[model samples]
Target: MRKIVHIDMDAFYASVEQRDDPSLRGRPVVVAWRGKRSVVCAASYEARRFGVRSAMPAITAERLCPEAVFVPPDFGRYKAVSRQVREIFLRHTDLVEPLSLDEAYLDVTRNKTGLPTATRVAKTIRQQIRDETQLNASAGVAPAKFLAKIASDWKKPNGLFVIQPHEVLDFLAPLSVARIPGVGKVMEAKLARYGIRSVGDLRSWDIFELERRFGRYGLRLHELAHGIDHSEVKPDRPVQSISAEDTFDIDRFRDELGPAIRQLAEKAWQATRKTERLARTVVLKLKTDQFKIYTRSITPGDSINNVDEVSALALLLLQRVELPADTRYRLVGVGLSNFYEPGQLGGQTELFGNEF
Candidate 1:
């Protein structure tokens, strides 16, 4: 059986804020803007007691908890801490796949640190993160990524849970059908209407009947309900594309557009740097207040070398959007696509000083 470990930091952003600022510890904290158009990005456990949650509007969050402390996100500091946690992960296994800034999957079947079990490796990594960054982490160890991910969330902040091969079925059977990935609120309600609440209920459905009702996802749900996930831990996953997106508090000024594009380019560059590939196409994504999405892309003559090139290409694409300066926007994003390895082309040297 394959050994996979999922590590997820507890209340990542809010935890970091509390760790850095001693005064904020143990108090209800919400990391978000205190503006009319802003939404909560993350809420500490204390804040969650008052029904505060991520993505909820700031006004609603205030109504839920009048005493809640609100703080804006600091991506730079969070990225630095994420890197520190990544370094801790690297010490044990090279087969690390980061799902986001605060969560990742590590295949430690044969670890570099000579760890005997995946659980041991998880314990050591969690301890190291706490020692180095003063942050708490939760971990789950199982034979597959899906189970490991769910196990990790079994217990909150500073918890470690393991699902051995023998216990997989029993552990999964009692869980709600909504625990399966991709089964959102709508699907859960649909399942509930049929008196199917848990994985056990899903197991009672015939495969053909599930396929008839829900199509391809039904098959996946059937397999997941039985604790079967065949996905492998890919150590050398290739980068298909690089992108950056931001949801603005409000529409930005036309003159202020340059700064926002530059900022997004920097973010895209940072995201691309995590991979070992070069991109030839740059794409810009814009979303208006009405939720209409628009995209424009250009394949540059040469591979994009730095943030400056990305910014320039993005600005050029922005001109294609017919919207006027006063057009209110809800979101903006920049991306790089059409990737290739640096040495894949004959004698094509690195175009820019930036290396992925």
Candidate 2:
């Protein structure tokens, strides 16, 4: 069995604030701007008790916890601390897949520190993070990523849980179907209609029936319900593309479209720098309220190397599409694709076009 460990920092941003400031430890703390439209980036466990949560509007968070302290996000500081956590993970295994700024999955079947058990490796990594950064982390050890991810959340805030290979099914059976990755509100509601409230209920369904409803995701859900995920821990997951999309609650105006597209393009461009890859194509995607999907793409003859070029190309692509004044869109997305290493661009001089 491949030993996998998932580590997640508890209320990452809010916890960091609490740890750095002694007085914030036991208080309800929400990390976000105190603006009507600003969303809570993170909420401390104390704030959670009052129904504050990440992504909730600051106004809603305030209404829920009137006395909660609000702090703006400090991304630079968070990234620095995240790097330190990654260093600790590297000491255990090079097969680390970072899920976000504060969470990662590590395959520790063979570790750099000669750890014999995944649980021990998790403990050591957590200890190192606490000692070096005074940050609390939760870890889960299992035979696969799915179970390990679930185990990590079993106990929150400086906790560790393990799901052995033989105990996987039992550990998963009673959990809600919503616990499964990608089974969001819509899927959960659909499953509930079928009386499939938990993994155990899902386990009773025939594989064919599930496949009929959810396509390939159905088959994957079946395996997950049985606590079987065979996905390998790939250490070198390449950055194929960087994209950002937002679905609006209501259709937006044409005048508002320009600003939204620019915002998404900027976000995508910023995300591209997270990986050491160069983008060769810019793409624009839109989904109308009627669920019609439209995509427009441009491959610059010259390598567009910076955010300014990306934004300009995105705007140009947007202008190229002829949308009716009445055509309201539910979603808009911007993306960059055809990523290559810096050295790989040397011979591709012809790829750059006048668009650049």
Provide TM-scores for the models: 0.70, 0.78
What is candidate 1's CA lDDT for residue 113? 92
Instruction: Tell me how far candidate 1 lies from the true structure as C-alpha RMSD in angstroms.
Output: 8.3
Which lDDT values do the candidates have, in the order given? 0.82, 0.81
Model 1 is weakest, by summed lDDT over 10 consecutive residues, at 347-356
- Using TM-score as the measure, the top candidate is 2
Candidate RMSDs in Å, in order, are: 8.3, 7.9
Q: After superposition, how far is residue 103 of candidate 2 from its true place, in Å?
A: 1.0
Task: Assess candidate 1 and give its lDDT.
Answer: 0.82
Q: How far does residue 351 in candidate 2 sit from its true spot (Å)?
A: 34
